[model samples]
Every structure is written in structure tokens, then in C-alpha cells.
Target: MSTGELSDERVTAAVRDATAAPSMHNTQPWRFRYLRSEGVFQVRADFGRALPHADPDGRALHISCGAALLNLRVALAHRGLRPVARLLPDPGDPALLAVVRPSRPEDGGEGGGGEGGLGALHPAVHRRHTSRLPFTETEIPQALRTALSDAARREGALLDFPGPSHLRWVLQLVEEAEARNRTDRGEAEDLARWTRAGTAGTSDAAGAAAAGDGIPEYAFGPRRFDGRAPVRDFAGTGRVSGRRAATFERHPQVALLSTVKDRPEDWLRAGQAMERVLLLATLEGLVGSPATQPVEWPDLRWPLRDPVSGRGQVQTVLRLGYGPSGPGTPRRPTGEVLDIRP
Candidate 1:
């Protein structure tokens, strides 16, 4: 896999896989520039798509780009090339998140997981989705939970399954955040601007078909009629015609993803770790969704940390279990997100 040997089609396919990574509000706020001469792809943040109200510090934006970077590595490894990634290669340019190039396996690469293991996850990349629907009551096995934590550790982050007491407290924070969102004008506006309507009776993919970004109506799943699941109601105060109400799991299976230090680089690592955990869970017959409402609010976020340890900064709360896989959200075209230079 030399510089000149890497075909344009391969690069395009890799970028396509990268864009499949989830983001806040499904914004897909990332851009890729392939430098043929250097044999590298630069991952940059698209500030135009940034959620100012929800993520004013751009932490979520960087996390979204980091997930895409991980996908690029997985895609290259699946293609029989070892992918090497360098995070924040240039401090002068903050938006330039990472530089990734394909190398021979013998040449090695950064990150813990081997090329083989990463490639094994390529299939799961596209298979994983944010399922907003209700999940069953079955508890995840201890073995699978351990494996998911290992996946996060390999990416320089921590995924903690809170105890009964801690879990109840975290859920309280989520409820508080939800209450705030209802009254916060700025948060409401962000939700409205990024969410789509007019797909009430149509398929999940139909609402996103026009915008190529944002959460669609059908993907909102049923509104939480009862139960303790922390599903976000994208509809806000408005009503979606023909939408049904359902009770979610009473004790939803949840995990908290966090990093030791809360810096830009750490946020990037958290994002990669988050996606790795998600893809592995999907491969192991699980559907999941990210519940970031608590994390989005500064006051509510600090209380989400494990009271026992209280070590890491919580990045995102994840809900995982056996449930219907969420419908695929629309993604911006490859041409729109990628730029190739000679």
C-alpha cells in the first residue's frame, strides 16, 4: 500500500465509511482532504455544522471527527492496509484534528488494537445505529460488558457501568436536563433547526432524505410514555402526527464513557473509544443509543461521575440492550465532505 498504489476509489470508499460515524444531532460535522503526494488523509472539523448552544466549546465537534477518524482506520485495515493516525498534528490549526495514512502491517501504527482486530470491526461500522426505541429487560452478560470496557481502554478512555445507586442518580440528572431543555430557549432552537418534520407516516429515512443531515421524525421512535429510559424527545413541545407512545425499559442498560482529562485531544480519544464500544456491542447482538442530554449541561454533567471513584470526566452516557436497530440516518455525499489534492 504505497502512496501511488492507493486508488481513488479506495480513498472514496474509506471516506464514505468514516462519515457513517455518529455525531451530535447527526450533524456529520467533519471534512476530509486527501493529499495524494503525502499519502495521508486530513480530518478537519466543519465549524459551519457546529452546535453552538449544545456544544459551545466544540468538544462534541471534535468527538464527532474522532469517531470518523477511527472508522478511517478500520476501513483501511479491512482493505489490507495498516492505518496510522496522528492526532492534533498541528497546534497552529485547531480544526485539523488528525492525519491518517495507510502503511504496511510490518510498519505498524499508533493505537492499541491490531490491524486484524480493527478490520474485524469494519462490518460493524455500518451495522451500528442509534436505536431510540425501547429495549428488552434482559441484562447484558458480564463477559460482554468486560469486552466492551476493554474496547474503550484500548482507545484511551473509560467505560463504567454504574452501580444501582449511581445509576439512579445519573438518571435523575438526565431528567433534570430534559426539564431544562424544555424551558431553555437556546436549546429548543438548536433542536428545531437540526430536526426534520413532515415524515410522520413515512419511513425513518424519508425525513433525512431532503437535508442529508439532522434527526428525522421517524427516527425519533415513540415518545416515552412511561419508564426510566433517558430517550430524548426530538419533537420538543410540538407534536408529530400519528406518533405513538410506548413504555421503555424500567432499568435501562446504561454505561458512562469518560476520559481522565477533559481536553480537546482527550475528547477526540473519547469519541473513538465511544464508537469502538458501540461497534463491538452491535456485533454482539445489541442495539444502542447515546444519551448526551446530561453531558450537554454543565451543571448536570459533573454529577454524572461515579460517586465511588469520581475520577474521569464523563463524556457521553450510552444506553445499550436488545432492541430494534435504529433506522439509518442520511449522510452527506462523499463528494460534499471529501477533497482530494494532487
Candidate 2:
């Protein structure tokens, strides 16, 4: 674990772990290059996969890349390597989201150091899936909530669990955004391009497909028979084999992840914090799904803030509870998304 240099096989393994991070519609909008001479991992944005209508400003794209970066860090830490990461390291190249170098020194088990904690979260990287099914009404323990909040704070972001009144208002904003998304031709086209009612991978099975990326029908959880969990319905009215309708929790537990500033760098940080919290949640025996409906719209985004304090700008809506973990969707092969320099 103390070995400073990484072999090509180890680098490939790290990139595989990084690609496991979730993205909007499973676009996997990220690329990685291992500079062998510099001993650095460069995380870049793949603009070719950008969702023009859903994320015109590339905020979500940056966030997705940040999530991948977090996974890469975790992978390195699990191997007892110190990952010193910098966000937006280069001013000249906007596509370079992050540059991570493995420091030579071993991380002491000191409380202040991040390496120990990140290594602890290594198992959750592959286990954490975006669960869209119904969750039990049982409340999450206060200690667990605090832990999740701390995870977010560690990456310079805030996790707010709204009260009943504020949650109702937030739900209203989601409904409004969903309504707008249904009527907007641009959004519909975007969804159609990234979602598949039949197999999304290459196979011809019902929920299976040959494609390496995109949301597969098998991963669509189930239809919300009668709850306001705010889960995105990828199927819409489209048909999928063996899809079922199920009742969800009456008062689903949700949380809002936000940042103090609304900038590109802030979005990138939020993405890392989002993944951190999610991985911690998974470790604590929780399953979750992301609902970005209100956050995606300019008009509704402002109202999503705390009604009284009006503090941070919300970036992600998370639904968490005890539920079945959704099936994993295929990722673009590591060879396709990674390049190794001589």
C-alpha cells in the first residue's frame, strides 16, 4: 500500500472504480488520463456526452465529473495512497476538472487527515446505487443524520433536511418542474435520447441492452402508485416488460444538498459532497435516489432554499430510506474513457 508508483494495471483499476460514480441519465460524462511521468490522474469533462437541453450551462456535467473524482480519491485511499486533489487546477483549460497526485507519505490515522475516512468509505463506492424504489417510513437515526451532514461539510457543502412545512413547499416546486419538463419539447427529446424502455445494453432481453451507457429499463425501480417521493419516472408513459406499480411511503424522507455560492466551481464541489454523503449513507444501511427536477430550473431553484433563512442554493434533492438497491446500469468501458500517457 505504501508503494508510491502505480502500475498500469492499478491505474486501470482506479479508473474502473471512478467510472462507477453515477451521472444524470447515466451519461458518464467523464474522461481520465494518467500522466505516467508526472504520476498524476487528470479528470476531464467529455463535452460530447453533454445533455444540451437538460444541462446547457454544463453545471451538471461538472458535478458528474466531481463525483467521479471523489470515487477516484476513495480508490486511491483504499490502496493506502494519499490523493492530493485540486479542483479546476488549470485556468487555461476549462475541460480539466481536477488533477490528483498521490503524495509519497503515508497518511497518519490522525482525525484531521482525510485519507483514513476516505479509505473507510471505499467499500461503498461500488455498493452504492441510486435506489428509486419505495422506502420504509422508519425514521433515520439522529446520529446517522449528523454523520451524513458531516460528510457533506467535509467537502465544503451543506446538507439540509427540511421540516414538514418546508418539505411541502419543496415538493410543490418539484411538481411544478415536472409539469414544465413534461410540456417542454427540448427536455423530452433529451430524455428520449438517454432513456430506453427496452434493453439499454447490447442484449435483446426486456430490460437488458448491448449499449454500455444510458439508463436501462431494469433500473427504473417502479411506478409511484401513490406517493410523493419525488423520484424521476424515466419510463414516463412508455412500456417496459414486467414493470409494476407500488405504493411508496406517505412521508418520504428527503434531504437537500447545497452550497453557499452558485458558481461552476461550487457546483463541482457540491458534486463531490453529494457523492461523499451518498457513500456514507450507503455505508449506514441506507438507499437513495437523486431528484434534480426543481434544481434544474432557474425559476424553481431559488424557491428551493429555506423559506426563512434563504441560505444555500440547493443543488440536489435526495430521497433516502430502507429499500431495495436498484440494479446497476452499464458504464462505458474503462478503455473508452481512459488514456495513459507514455
Candidate 3:
């Protein structure tokens, strides 16, 4: 723990905190390499776990990695260390999403400490889970909404709680996107590979639920018996035996998280902003889930922007409210995704 060096133990702990980030289908398509000589941690994309058809352009994959990068920053900041990060630092190396150097506070102020103030959100790193279950009809207070909006802004993104008319339009877009996914063979196959219910029977729920990756049966939440809530039915058209069906809220609250641009850097920023908003929401006693169906399709994505200003490209759709915290999803072990430089 010297001024110019970071201990192995501390770096490993930060990686563990970073892996707690949420990804599309829990794919967790990212790797970390500790550059001992440079005293920096590099976040790389693991294309093997990527959904080729669903995320052909790698937008979602980058966003997931961005979330992990954000967690890494928060973990280091909480330890009173400063983390300097660069996104897409090497143009030739596309997989190299970012490189973060954890520096001491008195090291001449090289890096901005990953926005330094994020240390307060360290606890929520593990407490926040994607609750797919139905949330109560309780509307989020205006103050909390404003706070969440600010959280996204601090990370260089926008979080918009669309009005009734806009929400209805967005819901229609989501429904259409879901229907398209239903018929797309590649999309279904990709989803099947990421969901465990296809291979896990009712009796073997324990084993399937223990998997180290993907969406488990236990975390699927209840069937949307009745409501406008946009819960993605991971089961697809297949039925899950013994799964309960529950009525969801009549009017679900949804937020559209977006960035000004749609490049890889923007995607990375959106992911960090997303984690910030989610962490803040958790601290405020709220559970959140992502509805990214519409954003996956190019035709559907453009319409997601605000009609008045006609700016901001939607990256992910988020649903937030009061409800039971969703079941924990597994992540690939640190060794599986991290490589240490000698």
C-alpha cells in the first residue's frame, strides 16, 4: 500500500465489487487485467459470453462492462484511494474497454478518483439487485426522482421519467419489440443460452439456481398476471412448472436512461450512469429492473427519445419501485474474468 503501488489484496477486492454489476441476461461479458507495472486495472470485453444476435453491435456488452467499471471506481474511492480511468484508450484494441489506475490521494492529484464522492455508495454495491417481481403502485416521490436524475447527470447521462402519453408510447414499443423477439430464432436461442429454466426442472431448481451465470429460475419473478408492468418473461413461450402467477401494478413507473451520443464511449458512460442511479435508488429504498427490449432494435430505439427536444439516445429502459429485492444472480468468479500481470 505504498504511494506508487497498490496491494494485490486491495485490487482483488475492488474487482469483486466490480463484478456485482448487472449485465444483460447476467452475461457479465468483461474481463479485468491488473497491470502491475503500470499500477492500473484494465477492463476488457469477453466476447465469448456475448449475445451475438441480440447484441450484434456490442452496444449492450459495452454498457455492461461500463457498469462494472463504475463499481470498480466506487470500491477504490471507498478505500480512500483515487482511481484514474480512460475509456477506449487504445483504438487498435477494441476489447480494451478501459484502464483504471488506483492512486494515492497525495500523488499530485493525477486522476479524479472516479468522481471521488461515490465512496458513500460502496455499501449499496452488493445490496442492489435487479428485482423482476412486481412493485407496488406507490409512486416515487418527486425528490427521489430528482435525486436519481441528478445521479445520472453526474455520470454524464440522462434519466427521463416520461409522462403518461410518452410512457404509453414506450410501452407499445416494448410490446412490439418483445413480439419481434418471440419470432426471431436467433434471439430466442441467445435468450435460452442465458436463462437456466430451459435446463432446470422444478425438482432440480436448487441446482439450476446455483449456476454461476445467466438468469436463474428463482429470479424470474412471477408471471405478469395483470398489469402494465414491463417485466421480461425470461421463460419465453415455454412454461415453468410450479412457478407462481401474481398480479402486477396497474401502472408501472418506468425511466429511460440515455446518452447524448451512441458511440462506444457513450455506451460506457451510460452504463456507469445506470449503476449510479441504481445505487442511489437502492439507498432510497427502491428496487429496480431493466427493460432493454426496445433499445435492442434500431428501429425501436430512435423513437424512444424525447419528441420535444428530440435529443438523447436511449440505451436502457429501467423500471423502479418498492418491492421485495430480487433473488441473487450468480457471477463468474474473479479468477474466471481477471488476469494479473506478472
Off by over 4 Å in 1: 107-116, 203-207
Poorest 10 consecutive residues by lDDT, candidate 1: 107-116
- Model 1's alpha-carbon lDDT is 0.90
TM-score of each: 0.96, 0.94, 0.94
Write one digit per residue (lDDT tens) for candidate 3, span 20-108: 99999999999999978888899999999889888999999999999999999888877877777899999999999999987675543
What ranking emerges by lDDT with the best candidate at the front? 1, 3, 2
Q: Tell me which of candidates 1 and 2 scores higher on TM-score.
A: 1
Give the residue spans of candidate 3 off by over 4 A: 1-5, 106-116, 198-206
Best by TM-score: 1
Encode model 1's per-residue lDDT on 1-342: one tens digit a residue: 455678889899999999999999999999999999899999999999999899999999988998998898888887877787899999999889999978876534442245327877888999999999999999999999999999999999999999999999999999999999988898988998899876655564564676799988878899899999988999888888988999999999899999999999999999999999999999899999999999999989998999888889999999999988998888989999999999
**What C-alpha root-mean-square deviation, in Å, does candidate 2 show against the real structure?**
2.3
CA displacement after TM-score superposition, residue 26 of candidate 1 (Å): 0.5
How accurate locally is residue 297 in candidate 3, as Cα lDDT from 0 to 100? 92
Best by lDDT: 1
